[model samples]
Target chain A: MGNLLEIKNLNVQFDIFGAHVQAVRGVSFELNVGETLAIVGESGSGKSVTSKAIMGLIPNPPGKITSGEIFFDGSDLVKYSQKQMQKIRGKDISMIFQDPMTALNPTMKIGKQIMEGLIKHQNLSKNEAKTKAAELLKLVGIPNPDKRLDEYPHQFSGGMRQRVVIAIALACNPKILIADEPTTALDVTIQAQILDLMRDIQKKTGTAIILITHDLGVVANLAQRVAVMYGGKIVETGTLEEIFYNPKHPYTWGLLSSMPKLHAKTDKLLAIPGTPPDLSDPPKGCPFAPRCPHAMKVCVDHMPDYTKLSATQKTACWLLDERAPKVDPPATIGVGGE
Target chain B: MDESREKLLQVKNLKKYFKVSRKDTLKAVDDVTFDVYKGETFGLVGESGCGKSTTGRTIIRLYEPTEGEVLFDGEEIGGKLSTKAKKNLSRRMQMIFQDPYASLNPRMMVKDIIAEGLDIHHLVKSDKERMDRVYHLLETVGLNREHANRYPHEFSGGQRQRIGIARALAVDPDFIIADEPISALDVSIQAQVVNLLQELQEQQGLTFLFIAHDLSMVKHISDRVGVMYLGNMAELAPSDELYDHPLHPYTQALLSAIPVADPKVERTRERIILQGDVPSPVDPPSGCRFRTRCPFAMEICAKARPKWHEAGKGHWVSCHLHDDGLKK
Candidate 1:
C-alpha cells in the first residue's frame, strides 16, 4: 500500500520570553495505510508538537511550524489555509486528545456532538446524521447507544467519555487518526479496554493510527512500528521488536531500563541521571549526552549521524559508529544491544 | 517477610464517609482492615474512587474515622485524646503527598516547609539549631545545603518531591504514609524518588504504608501488598506470591492489564480487559463490590459478601471463586 502520511524534516518552534524555543527539530517519519505507528517520548521531547503540526493546530504568534513538508494524499498541507485545513482535518485525518472531560462540550448532548461532525464533514441532514452518529457510537462499543445519545457529557464516566470522543473522530471515516495521550488519565484496566477498542476498530476499518504516548508498554501492545523521540528529534526508529529487543541508542537503553516491569524482579530502576535540556537555549551536541552513561568525547562535540542497522531499523547515536570504543550497554539491561 | 515483627499500626473495620448531600453519603473508605508491621512496606493498590487514598488518610488520622479502631504501637488511637497525646501521636506519623507543586507551601522557604513538623512539636532549642537540622535533612534527601534557602517553586517536580520527603522525615517519625508520591513525576525521574525512599527505609528503619495505583512500582518497593476494590480489601499477600498467583478475579485482571516493557511478552500475553468503568462507591454492588465487572461472577456473589480467608500460606483472598471445598 502507498504511504498514508509523510512528515519530512518537520520543524516546530515556540516563542518564550523573547527567546525562540525549537520544540520539534527536523523530525521525519512515514505511516503506511492500515498501520499503527507510535511516537514515544518524555514531557518536552516534541512528540506532541509533531502531531499538532500535522493537523495545523499549532497556535500563531508563539507557536509556528518554522519549516517542513507534510504530504497527505499527494498534497502539501503547509501551504493550505485555515479553511482548507479545516475541511481536511476531520474528513481526511482526525485527532483525539488526552483529557476526555475537556475535549467534550459539557453543555451539549453526546448525540448532537457526534452528529455535528457527520453533518459538517458528510453534509448530511439532521435525521441522517443522528442515525449515523448512533451507529458510530455503537461501533466504538458504547452500550445503550440510543439512550446515551441524549445524555450530556456530565452524565458519562471518564472511559465512556473517551469512547464518545473516539466515535466523533471516526464519524467521517478518516484515513488517519492522531491520538495524543489517549489513555494517560485512565486507570490500567480502563486503559487496556480503550486500547483494545482502538485496535479492534483499526482491524475493521483499516484506518492508520498515530499513537502519541510515553508508555512503551502501550506502544508494544498496539503499535506495529515505534519512533522514540528525544530533545525534539527522532533518536531511534524501528519495528517493535527492533526497538525493544535490538535498541542501539543510549537514550533508548536508559528508557527501557527505567521502567519498572511487571514481570521482572529488579531491586532498583536504572534512572537516567539529569534533566532534559533547556529548549530555549539548546546545546550544540546531542540532547542525551549529558545523561548517557556511555558518553564518549565525540558524543560531547557534535550530533551523531543516523546509522542504519537493518532495512527497517535506524538510530542516531555515536556509540553505533564502527570506530567508537566497544563500550556495550551496561550488562544490567534485560534486552537489546548484546 | 518478618512475620514476628511488632505491628506499628493496626486498623480494624475502618470507615470514612463523606456527606455528599443531605440525603446521600459517600463511603470513601468502607469496612477496611490491615496491619503495617514495623520496618516493613505495605502497599495498597486500586483504581481511582476505589478509596486507596482515603484509606491512607484515615490511617494517618487526617480524616476522622466513622466507625473502627486504629491501634498505634498497641495503643488505641481511634477516639478523642488529650492535647499532649494527640500532638505526640502526630509526631510519630507523617505524610508525603502526591502533587509536589501543590503540597509544598509556595510562600514559605524550603527550610520552613521541612521544619513545620519540628516547629509544631517544639523540637528546636534555637533558630540556628532549626537551620542546621533543615540543612542536614536537605543533604539526606540528595539535595544540597544551598537549596534550603530557596522556595518550593524554584525546584523541579522530582526535586520538589525530595522536599516533601525531607518534610515527612523532619520530625523523625516511625511510620510514613506516602499517597501516590511518584505518580505525578515523569518516568525517568520516578526511579530517583523510588530509590531515595528505599535508602531512607533502610537507614531509618521506618515502616511505610505506600498507597499508589502503579502496581509495578508498588511490587518493587513493598514487602506485602493489598488489593482494594470499592473501599474493601480484595486480596492481601506477600509481593512475590501475589504477583505469581493472584487469587481474586479483580487482582488477576489488574495484574494482567499492566504492559511489560518487553515486546515479546506483551504481545503474547492474554490481557483481561474488564467490561466497563468501576462502579460508583456510594451505591456499590449488593454483595461483592467487584461483581459488576468481574468475569467469573456467580449467583452467590450477589447473595453475600465473601469473607476474607486464607487460600494458602500467607495468601489471603476475598472472592467467591476462592471459596472451595469448605463443605468438607
Candidate 2:
C-alpha cells in the first residue's frame, strides 16, 4: 500500500576516456512495500546501474549518479554520505549480486560470510551471529546448516552457492531485497527452486524486492509488476498482466515476441531489426526508434512523453499519442495460448 | 519429409570420457547415439554438465571419440584418418562456438578471421579472390565490407556472432555444429541470429547439430530434438512430438521446468521442481543416470540401464517406465 522506495528521474553516467556514456537517462519508478518489481532488459539497459545507485555501490571515479533523487524510507538517499549509506545498506536494504559464483568470497567460510552482515548491521555477538547464520542457511533450504557452515564456497554446488548468497542477503532481515539476475547462472530446474524459495521467503519476511533480469519468463514467474527498459530508459511500466497480455511499446512487443513460447507453433520469430543504440552517442529521440517497426517521423525527432494507459500501465511511445496513426500489435505478440 | 532424406551424420554409441584422475573418469558423452537427416536441424537440449557441448565437439572432431562410430556422409570419420582426410573433414563439418568474443581472434582483423578457413583450405586463388570472398561472406551474414577491416573488439556481441557465422560459412560446410550460438546474444538479438541460421539452413541445405540449454529456442529451430542427461540420450523425436508427448521422465521434467514468458500461464501452470542439483559428472548415478532426480523413478531404474528403444512412431526413449518387458 505504501511506497518503500521511490526513484525519481534517476540519471547515471560513466565518463570513460573522454566520452560520456549515459547509462540511466531520467528513469523513474516506485517499489511498493512487500511487492516484487522486476526490471527486465538486455545488457547496458541501465537496470543494474539503477539498482547500484540505490545501494550507493556506484564507483565515483568512472561512474556517478549525475542527477535525480533516490528516496528510500522518506529520506533522499542521493544526498547520503558513504558512511551513512554503509550503515543503511545491509540493515535496511540488502542486495544479491548478479553472479553467485564470484559474489561469495572463496577463502572465507560460508558461516563467517553470512555472519559478517549480521554482526556489522545488527550488532550481534559472535556466537549469536553464528547461530543466526546457521538458521538463515536452513531457511534458504540448504541441507545440514550447522555442518555446512564450515564449508568453503567452492565446496558447494552452483545451486547451493546461490542459496548461500540468498542466506547472506537475508542475514540481516533487511526490509528491501534487491536480487539482480539471481537465477541467470543456474539451470532452469534450479532456477525454479530458487524462485520458489524467494517467494516463500518473501511471504514470511514481507521484504520488498527489486528483481533485475533479462529473462522475461523469470519475471513472469516471480514479479507482480514489470518495468521494460531499453537503451538506458524505461520504455514501459505496467502490471505483469498488462505487460504480458496488453503491451504498448514496440520494444516490449519485440522482446515478448522474440522469445518463442515453449509450445509456440510459429516457425520464425518476429525479431527486432538492428541493435541497441550506443550509450556514448545515444539516439536523439526514442532509443528504440531505430529498431521499432512503427517508428514515425516524430519518434526519431523527439522523445515521447509517458502516456498513462491504465491505472497501473504507462508507456513512452509516439504510437500511443492521439494524433499518431493507430497501429495494432502483431498477432503473435501476446504470450498466452488463449 | 525426414525419412525420405538421407542421413547426413549417424552417431552410433558415441563415447567421450575424460580422465580427470588416474582413478576417476568423467563420462562427458557416454554412448550417445543420434542421426542428423540430410537437411534438418537436430536440436540437442540439456542442462549444464549434461554433455551436450561435448557431444557436439566430439562429432566435429574437436575432441577425438574415446569409443564409438561417427559416420558422416556414409563414411567412418570418427576413426583415425590421414591428415588430408582430417583437413577435408574439417572443411565439410565446421563449428560455431558459444562465446563469440572468446571464439574469434581478437588480434586479427575481421577479414582475416573470416578468411582463416579460406586460407587453411586454399579455397581462394589470389589475394583479390581471398578479399572478395571475405567481403562476400561478411555480406552473407548481414555485415558490410567495411566491417571486415575492423577488429573483433569493435563489434557488438550480436555482430561478433554474425562474424562467427561468416567464418563458419566461409568453408561452405555441409554440416555445422552450432553449440549455444545464440546463448550469449541479447533476447531481441537472439531471434535475429536464429532467423539468420534458419535462412542459411534453408538456402544452403545445411544440416545442423544445434546444441543449447534453451528448450524453447531449440524446439523452434530444430526439426528433430534429442534430450540428453549426464552424457546419455534420454529421448529423441520430432520437435513437436518431443514437446507434446514426452515419454522419458527426464524429458517431461525438463519441458515442465522451463518458465514460459506468460503471466497467466506461469501463474496457473504446475511446475515439477526436481529436488537437489545435478550430480558430479566424475561419478554420475548408476543404471539410469536420471533416476536420482526423476520423480517417476522406479526401483529397476537404479538397478539397470533402461533400453533405448522406440516408444512411439519415431519417438525414441530410454526409461524403465516405457519398457514393456520390465512393466510385465
lDDT of 2 by residue, A1-338 (tens): 99999999999999998999999999999999999999999999999999999999999989998899999989999999999999999889999987889999999999999999998988899999999999999999999999999999999999899999999998888989999999999998898899999999999999999999999989998999999999999999999999999999999989998998786688789998998999999889999998889889998989999999999999999998889999989898664644
Question: Total clashing residue pairs per candidate?
Answer: 0, 0
Cα distance off (Å), candidate 2, residue B48: 0.9
Q: What CA RMSD would you report for each candidate?
A: 1.7, 1.1
Worst 10-residue stretch by lDDT in candidate 2 chain B?
Answer: B1-10
Off by over 4 Å in 2: A335-337
Per residue, candidate 1 scores C-alpha lDDT tens digits across B1-328 of 5578789999998999998988889998888888889999999999999899998888778888899999999998888778888899889999999999999999999988999999999999999999999999999999999998899989999999999999999999999999999999888899889989999999999999999999999999999999999899999999999999998999999999997777778767888889988988778889999999999888888989998888887788888788874321
Off by over 4 Å in 1: A332-338, B324-328
Which residue pairs in candidate 1 have backbone atoms (N, alpha carbon, C) closer than 3 angstroms, thus clashing? Answer: none
Using lDDT as the measure, which candidate wins? 2
The CA lDDT of each predicted structure is: 0.90, 0.92
